[model samples]
Target: MILTVTLNTALDITYRVPRLRPHASHRVTEVTERPGGKGLNVARVLAALGHEATVTGFVGGGTGRALRDRLAAVDGVSDALVPVSGPTRRTVAVVDESTGDTTQLNEPGPHVSPAEWAAFQEAYAGLLGSASAVALCGSLPPGVPVGAYATLVRAARAASVPVLLDTSGEPLRRGVAARPDLVKPNAGELAELTGSHEPLQAVRDTRRRGAHAVVASLGARGLYALTPDGEWRAPAPDRLAGNPTGAGDSAVAGLLSGLLDGEDWPRRLARAVALSAATVVAPAAGEFDAGTYEKLLARVSVDRVTS
Candidate 1:
């Protein structure tokens, strides 16, 4: 089983409109709500792909209850959400149909007290014991230490479970010091961490910062993996477009799914690239088109980088 941690869970609301006009209201043709936060998104994708995934983190109040109930509806996904006193957060994504671009508005997330943090640590320790691998995703909420993910990485190491971290800013900086087995960061986050927008160079520097391997999500340029085996780049399929929200999370799900199956390293890169492309083609945010994923998986090209 793969255990995923999300410190700030949310109920994500996605809206689709023909175009986004500043200071003007438009009729939204669609609105979809789901249990979200990065880890939940990963669990959803893994479940869709027939992987057993357990999600655990801080969930609060009425929103938390709704989030858990909704997640339970997705087959093959399980949750061990730690209940907190506050309300779960809400994230909004506005999709422009004409250009297939998405503008996101996110809430900062709820406050987690020290007691709640302790409760989470207890739950996590138990989850780590049985999990084949662990993924620490998304941002930290209030009252949680900035280095919280770093601590989680340490615990996963002690249990001998490979840890995959997908986060940003200080949490990422701290977590890297623990030398996680894998770290996936999008280009913007990668730039923030290493001050290099050049994808390969950034990934190489990120590897030097203690990620055993660095997989940089280059958006439409597809996926790049820098590991002991070598560096591989897979570009996303062209001539297809849609909302790009959650593509990175879906890619993480794909790569981790491959890892759980004991797939060869190159195959893992292919899986990540394929899923990410499928996610871009999906009209809805955070969900991938299953058909597209299957097709992209077959055509994704993986080539080694000499340097």
Candidate 2:
């Protein structure tokens, strides 16, 4: 089983518009909603790949209930979310049909009380006992300590479970100190964390900061991984065009799935790159076309980096 922690879960709403113009009003052609946040996205992708995933984090009020209801309907995912007094937040993604661009409006999640935080910690610890691997993902919600991921990483390590962390800013900085087995940061997040825009330099700096290994997501270029065994650059066969919102989370699912199967780094990178590309072409976030994934998996190229 895989354990995924989302500190700030959300009801993700996507709106399709004919065109987005500044200071203009238009009818929304379509609306779709789903349980979201990076970890939830990862869990959804993992479940799609036939892995049992447990999602834990804070949720409350009407929106939270709605999110949980959807989770209950989804197969292969268990909801272990802790309740808070404040209502869960929502994120709106306005997608332009003409240009395939997205305009995003996000709400800060519910304020978590100290009591809720404690309850979450206890629940997470119990889940870790049965988890084959764990992923700590996304932003820290209000009233939650910045070191939350660090603490959770430590607990996973204590249980002898390999953990993957995907976050940004101070939370990521602190979490790295716990020496997680792996850290996945997109290029921008890597730059913000290490002050280097260059992918190779940034990943190395992040590793020096404490992560045992670092996998840098370079958007459509694919993934650059620096691990104990060596380094490798995995590139997509072709630049895919579509919604890339959940591509990173899909990659996270790939890495965890590969880890569980005891696959080598090259295979892991291939799976991740293929999954990410598949998500790019999928109709929605946290989803992929099985046929595309199968085709891309064999096409993804993994080349070792020697310096």
Candidate 3:
């Protein structure tokens, strides 16, 4: 089973409008809500890929309850979230139907007390015992330590579980030093961490910082990976038009699943790129269209990068 940790879980709400106009109200065409956060999104994708996934994070209040309710309905994923006093947050994504653009509004999650933080750590440790691989993902909530992911990475390593980290800013900086098995960062995050906009150089600098392997998402160009085994660039077959939200999480899922299956780096990159592209074309946030994924999987080209 795969374990996913999301410290700042959220209820993802999406709104569709004919077109977004400045200072003008538009009629809403559709609305959808789901449980979200980088880790939870990864869990959902992992479940869809025939993996048993368990999600543990902080959740509270009506919004948290609603998120859990939706999570319970997902078939292959199990909920192991810890309860918190502060209410969970909500993220709003407004999609412009005409242009296929998305505007996102995010809320800072509830403040977590020290007691709640302790409880979550204990819960996470317990979950790791049964997890084949673990993913520590997303932003830190109010009052959680900045070194939270670093701490979690240490625990996973001590437990002999392969861990993947997907986050940004200071948390990611610290987490990378913890020497996670894998780290996936998008273009901007990579540049921020390594202070270099060059993908190859940035990934190399990132690995030197302590991550055993680094996979940098290059948006439509697909993924660039630097690992002890080798380096490779996997590019998407074509850019599909849809919401690009959750594409990175899907890529994380792909990489984790491939790791457990013991596939080579090239195959793992192909899977990650295909899943990311599929998520872009999906109608809802954090979901991948199965047909699109299968169709693109064989087409994703993985070219070895010679240093």
Candidate 4:
């Protein structure tokens, strides 16, 4: 079973407008709300792919209640969140059809107290024991230590379970020290983690930081991964002409699902790239069309890089 950790879960709101013009009032034609946070998104995808996954974290307030309800509503996924003192976060994304660009607004999550942190740790420990593989995802919420994911990685290692980490900034920097089996970082996050503007070089740089493997999401360039075996690239099927907000999360879901199936590195990379492109073409945030994903899966091309 897969265990997904999301310390800062949210209600993600996505709006679609015909065009984005600065300082101009625009009417939204579409609106979507989903239970979000990287790990929750992972669980959602895992469920869609027919994988058993349990999610844990700090969830509180009315929004937290809604999030739990929504997550539970999705079949084959379960949550074991520890209730905290403050409300969950809310994130918004505005997509413009004409330019296919998305403008995002994010809120810093509520502060977690010491007691809440302790309870979360206890819940996570229990969840970790039951997991075959664990995915620690998303950003560090206020009051959580930067090395939180690192600690979880170490625990997973001790339990002999592979750990996948997906996050940004200092949390990622510190987490890599614990040597997670895999790390998924989008291009911008990869740049921050590896300090290399050249993306392929940044992927190599990530491996040097102790991740057993690094899957770097290259947006339109598709997926680039560097593992101990070798480096590989999988391009998306043609070019997608839509909002691409949740592409990376879909790619993470692909990688973990591939790993759970015992797929080789190349197949895993192809699956990730294809799922990401499908998410891009699907429209809205964190949503991928099943049919598009299936079709794109066949068209994704994976190649080895031996330089």
Best model per lDDT: 3
Count residue pairs with overlapping backbones in model 2: 0
Q: In model 4, where do residues sit more than 4 Å from their true spots?
A: 16-31, 95-101
List TM-scores for all candidates, in order: 0.94, 0.97, 0.96, 0.93
Worst 10 residues of 3 by lDDT: 235-244
User: How would you encode candidate 1's per-residue C-alpha lDDT over 1-307 as one tens digit per residue?
Assistant: 8888999999998899999999998999999889999999898898888889999999987878888889889888888999989889888889898986778898877789999999999999999999998999999988899999999999999989999999999999999989999999999999999999887888989999999999888877878889987888887778766767788898899889999999987789889888887887886678899998898888888888785
lDDT of 4 by residue, 9-121 (tens): 88888888999998999999998888999888888888889999888887888888888888878888887888988999988888888986779898899898878887888
RMSD versus native structure for model 4:
2.0
Residues 100-183 of candidate 3: C-alpha lDDT, one tens digit per residue: 788999999999999999999999999999999999999999999999999999999999999999999999999999999999
On the 0 to 100 scale, the lDDT of residue 116 in model 3 is: 95
Deviation in Å, model 3, residue 25 alpha carbon: 4.8
Displacement of the residue 103 alpha carbon in candidate 2, Å = 0.7
Looking at model 3, how many pairs of residues clash? Answer: 0
Best by TM-score: 2
**Clash number for candidate 1:** 0
Model 2 lDDT per residue over 1-307, tens place: 9999999999999999999998999899999999999999999889989999999999999999989998899899999898889999999999899998899999999988888899999999999989999999999889999999999999999999999999999999999988999999999999999999888999999999999989989986789999999999997657587878888999999999999989999999999999988998988766887899999898888999999
CA displacement after TM-score superposition, residue 198 of candidate 3 (Å): 1.2
- The parts of candidate 1 lying over 4 Å away from their true place are 16-30, 96-101
